[model samples]
Target chain A: MPKRACYAQDYTGLKILHTLYDSCLKAEIDFLDDHYLLNLIVDEGCIKGAIFLDSHTGEIIQINAKAVVLATGGYGGIYHGYTTNSYGSTGDGIAVVLRAGGAVSDLEFVQFHPTALKRSSILMSESARGEGGYLVNSEGERFIDELKPRDEVARAIFRQEQEGKEVFLDVRHLGEEKLMHLLPQEVALCKLHEHIDPAKALIPIKPVAHYSMGGIEVNSSLEVQGIQGCFAVGECANAKVHGANRLGGNSLLEITSLGRFAGDHAHQYTRSASNKEANSTQRDKDQKAIEAIYAQACTLNFYEKQQALGKLMYEKVGIQRENTQLLQAMEEVRAMQEMKEQMGIADKSPIHNQNLIEYLEFSSALLLAPMIISSALARNESRGAHYKIGFEKQDDKHFAKHHIIQWKREI
Target chain B: MTITILRSHNKQEEAYPLEDKERTLLKALTDIKATQDASLTFSAGCRASVCGTCAVRVNGKEQLACAYKVQDQDVIEPLQYHEVLRDLKVNKSLTKKTLQRSTAWLQTFQEASLTPKDEKFSEKQSDCILCDACYSACPVYAVNPDFLGPFALTRAYRYSSDKREADTKTLVDNVQSNGVWDCILCAECTLACPKGIDPKTDILMLRSLSIEQGYTDPTFVQQSFGFDPNAGF
Candidate 1:
């Protein structure tokens, strides 16, 4: 097989991130390091700028720009405890886009990587299988094809765990030298996190929420469809390049390629002479909204709801989805949203208040949960990552077009 | 289990008696934040140690919170020699400046093909996560605050060794002042690096490379006998 992607050892993403960050620094770009995005500032469908809360001082600030690009990443963090995303991948940008009356597309197609470290939900890179690793059950039987697509492999592993058998990634045949030479990060991670060296031991693994293929809808030029001067790229924008299922290693390609295009288009948009008025009213509204969150009665703990959301998303709306479970998940998420008024943070410090940030992030995830579940329910076919139990076959005839969800006031 | 965390907000150590369960320091800290104190602030990403945002000092040793297992009577504090944002969260903005100051990336986008053997040469150096563990552990930062710390110099070595890098002269010039020569080579950074990257050796290699470029140690040049700064005799 030909190599689909270029890699710098096992730390490809890290290397790419460092290169980009270095380039930004060398270019003398101004960086607001600890600012947390609060909301977008849009006036008459044209994006003015955004509002952010300085995590250090807890002061709300608004910046007005001619062109705004949302590269804030994906919604995989919505799954919480069962996701391989970062602590801050709470779909805040996607939710903010929706609330600002922008459309979100293909949000139901969430790709679950077949092998995440079972304990910490950390990703075990796909190269494990690419390097001839085997997926074995407790009985040491290879059940499914290890080389299958991500969604199928994830479902097979999910089925095995459902039948009360544990699945493991057996790479012992690869030998210690070969394992270390090929996948050094995997070896170090298994040894340090699980206390099981993969060279000698069977590494326990499971599928977890890894990537969100769906996000804010964008056109060929990577601009958000309805909103002018607004562009969403990377995981935050659904450019329809991946459709329902994204192939492994394609996301990096998408980000690098479309990310550049988004930047270029945004820069071009800024160059055009349009001296627009700043949306100062939205900043005040956002500030009041944040203050309101601080004033809410602390009747329901946000952490409990956040954990419950994770469990609910993983169990019900996860790999094997059905109509009843989808409906149940939808109702539960809506109920949580109804009780949102009672959920408040105990920490009121005007500093790096993680509690407040997490509370805001959870609220964003909560707002997008129904959108995902409803999209899953609307599409009654198993296509790509959306594996509906009753409709396991892809019915392209009915669900061929893009499934888009716009925030409606009547919800 | 008793856990003592250096809380930055109140400038004191706060202890929490936690249940002795199998968990990482990050999970334990998160639990404390959720149930015990909501005012606790820490940074974590990718929980897998790949992102490297969750580094904290565990009993005076730098460890990624997600990678380090929790033990009884474990003490956790923010990384050393940096501005602390809160409990266990330190400002990492210095990493960007140091990397920029070192000119650590390829100077020009010249294309060069590489075989497996070529890639393996600098493979170890490419594994840095910029977690700042090495920066936190280096004693040189305590004195010379402007020394282009371990991770940056290692990155500078990474690019300088790259086959595609056309010019290391500018990069070598950039690291002359507070760059490679400033390293005492204590290897404290090598021990603290969670990714196992050897920055001390990389700095030594940079020093040798500097000599080939007709540059000597600044310390030797500044000595009274080596160079007559007073212009006497």
Candidate 2:
């Protein structure tokens, strides 16, 4: 069971953040687009901006800011081919800290949303069920409670999919008028992408990568456990508020409330902090790091390897994981790490070099995959999103306490 | 399947044999980018169409690549009314910048006092993903590059109509000249919206609000409200 039956709700983060970004722009916040973070710049325990690959012009920029916030959403993109995450949610921030020897708790629990479009893995809002809808298997039977815990509902859907049954959300009873009135956005998305009319037809939905319940373990202050001057909130921080499973409706509330809390703390932290690092020195190191990536042998293709890694994670470390598959995932992650070294940059020219940015994303993903597999393996019990078929029971005696990986060694 | 992409650099169409699974145009384009040509570029995010970064010109029609299906011999090109950065990638910042000019931010944010009714009012306008499909499809942008365009005008309506607004006059006054009144309700923007957000309808609504505020346009009157068919000031 999840830590308290968290409220169930659906949200479009980008839409919510549209106003947030509007406010950010109003406050004269500078945005650096197309630049990918290579690594965090930590000097003597406090964070000092980051080193990034300028996607445009390919120069290495050393951003030594007062404070850094790791609100990079979740690592559901780690599932690769099957996920509802945007391409940029590569767990870059979390991966950086973990690689630099930091701690992250509950890293294994990845929440799979009950419904996603079967082909593209685009999200089908949970509001479909909440709005008096029903989930029926191929034979047209409501196999499970629509408003149950996400893990239970997702598992039900997944089990149905395994049994050679296509699962669908039947909202035809709601009629076109109510759907257009109450759930206009989901209706439009369904019609636009899937060509399904929610008012009349069955919307094909399957469990796919949705959210990472586990993140960089942050304390009450929302500061990263071992790392200094880095704050995390939203899906990137493990407050352990959502224990084994997150309640269906409470993700937005957690992020909105906790995100504001983190924002306040980060603001104060930045105000009290002073710039200490010399840019020239950091720039030289950043420049060297960028060159080193290009100087390495160009044998492995980062994009191909990344796609393979995503599919691999989806199969082995996905919704259902066992000891053997987890071990295989660990082995593959190690191999991918080797490939990351000799990653060949396709477009060396820094003018909007997506290749380099994607490579950086893949690097972060490779770093995260091993941690996720190991964390899932260490738990040895089915809890929340980390439900292994072999161990169906939630062993609260040993697994009740949160699992934290104190990453101290650089990978 | 063979896919034809209108390359931005040389302004030429390059054809490639589409390999692998049938996916969204954006996903297919991405696959082509990753394997076929590393330089092939386009902007996309939140493949769910909520982010609205994947707008492009498909068959010379503005469409969200993430939502548009790839067809055989389709002429895929960068979205119109924006500077093309790379293949199928056009700069839509101008559209977003104009939103600032239109004062799209909610000035009166009484979150606690806000009810579900207040939200339902601009529900359609709030659906703008800033994908710029409407902006790209706006023929007004073709004539007046500075036209505040569809999405921005729609956003103006979104913020202007918000009940918490202490005064919508500032928002109203912002979209006066090259903004709301400049919109040509050709319904192209309506057709382009992936979220089914009728920017045309929203623009017309803003025009109505403008008229209420004593703002007038000969084009709007002659086109929308019928300028008495014979009399005009």
Candidate 3:
């Protein structure tokens, strides 16, 4: 196969990031590193900049801008340990947008990659199976077609696990030379993390939460509806290009294509829009809310609650869903919100308080969980990633439309 | 298994217990954070090692926390010479500066063509994750903090070697001061790289290119003991 001179094997994403970061530096772009987005300030359907927490000094600062474009990535961290998402992928941006009355679509369609390494939840790429690898069960049988869509393979692996059978990605027959030449990253990951060489032993594998196909709704120009001068792009925005289950490589497509549109539209908006001072009332409200969270008594463990929520979402609202399980999941999610009053941070330092940051991320995840469950429950038929047990067929007649969720609206 | 972590707040090494399980060091740290202590702080992203946010020193060697397997009695610390943000977290704000200082990105362009061999040769140099493992490992920082370091020099080399670069001389000139010629050729950065990116060789290549471009080693010029104006007499 002919390879491009710039292609760096499986590290294309890293290479691109480095290249972009370098380009940004060359362009002399100012970067506020180690800052966390606290809240997006919107008043009268216009963006009024955003609130940020400086992680270095633990200071809340507001930067006023005419337009706000959120490229904050996805919300796959709700599955917690069973996800390939980073710990920071707690859907904070999406949750904040929802709180600001932004409509979110397809919140139920979380993509699950089928071959994440079992112990570590590190993703094993689809090329592993594409290279004639077999998805084998404990009985040494090929239970599911390895080349099926991501959702189907994930559901199949989930069913296998339910039957008390462990799944492994058997690629030993592909030979070591081929793996080294084609899938060096996968081979290296397996050798280092799992301690089992994929060329010799079966790689213990399972489905893991990977990508979120749902996010804050955006139009063709990547502008958020109902909110002027507010735009969302990348994984945080549902441009509707990825309808239910997104195809592989389309995330990058949306990123490059819609990302350009977002930049252009945001630039044009800022040209005509007038900047306003940060809303003092909303800033005070946000500050008081954070202070109240800090002042709460440490009775319930937030980590335990997060763990429980992750388990519930993974089991009920995960690959396979049903009416009763989703309802139970919603009830439990609501209960978590009620239980949030007793949770407080143990790390109260003024600098680099990761505990506070993670707790806030958990709060956002908790806020978004009910929406996901309700969205999953409202769409009765199994379509794409949302697989309900009784409603297994894709019913395009009634439930074919995207399930859009907004604040104070019924699912 | 017990993992000792250097806490940044008090500057003390604290030991945490981990259950005997098959897990990466990142997972163990996360487990400790979730169950044992909520105050434990570290930076991690893209747990499969694509994102280089989780690089840490395990028993005096740089390793990505998400890629290294957990071992008993492993002492983990933040990457050396960086301002520790918290426990096992260091500020990488200077990463962009390094790239800027080296003029790492393609500055000049020309219409050109490349062979498959050129792609194969450039593959190793382009895999840098900007994790700063090489920067943390390089002993050059102990002497000169302004040194452009490994990944930046490698990136400079990556662009200079490209056939599309119209002017590689300026990029080479940019790296002459605090950049390529100062490297001690220690190979520590190469050893520390998680992606197996050989920054030491890249720096050496940059040195040869610098020589080809009529650039002299600044250190050698400063310490020219045998230079005499009357040698021709």
Best by DockQ: 1
The residue pairs found clashing in candidate 2 are A7-A249, A7-A250, A8-A248, A8-A249, A9-A249, A57-A350, A58-A350, A101-A407, A102-A407, A244-A384
The C-alpha TM-scores of every prediction are: 0.97, 0.90, 0.95
Better of 2 and 3 by DockQ: 3
lDDT of 2 by residue, A1-411 (tens): 243333212335555677787787667677776667666776666777777777666787877878778777788888887888999888887887775556787888998888887767878777677778999988999999998888889998988988999999999999988787766767877887778898989999889888889988898889887767788888888877888688764677787789889888888898778668635555676688767766677776688887898899888888888899999889988988876767877766557766667777777788788989998999888987888977999887888887788855542
Clashing pairs in 3: none
Tens digit of per-residue lDDT, candidate 1, span A286-396:
889889877877877889889999999999899989999999999899889989888899988878888899998998899888888988999999999999988998998
lDDT of 1 at A85: 92
DockQ of 2: 0.49
Instruction: Mark the 10 consecutive residues where model 3 chain A has the least summed lDDT.
Output: A1-10
Docking class of 1: medium
Alpha-carbon deviation at A280 in model 2, angstroms: 4.4
Model 2: CA > 4 A from native = A1-14, A191-195, A278-282, A409-411, B19-22, B109-118, B218-233
Task: Give model 1's TM-score versus the native structure.
Answer: 0.97
RMSD of 3: 2.5
- Provide fnat values for all models in the order shown: 0.92, 0.50, 0.88
TM-score of chain B of each: 0.94, 0.88, 0.96
CAPRI quality band, candidate 3: medium
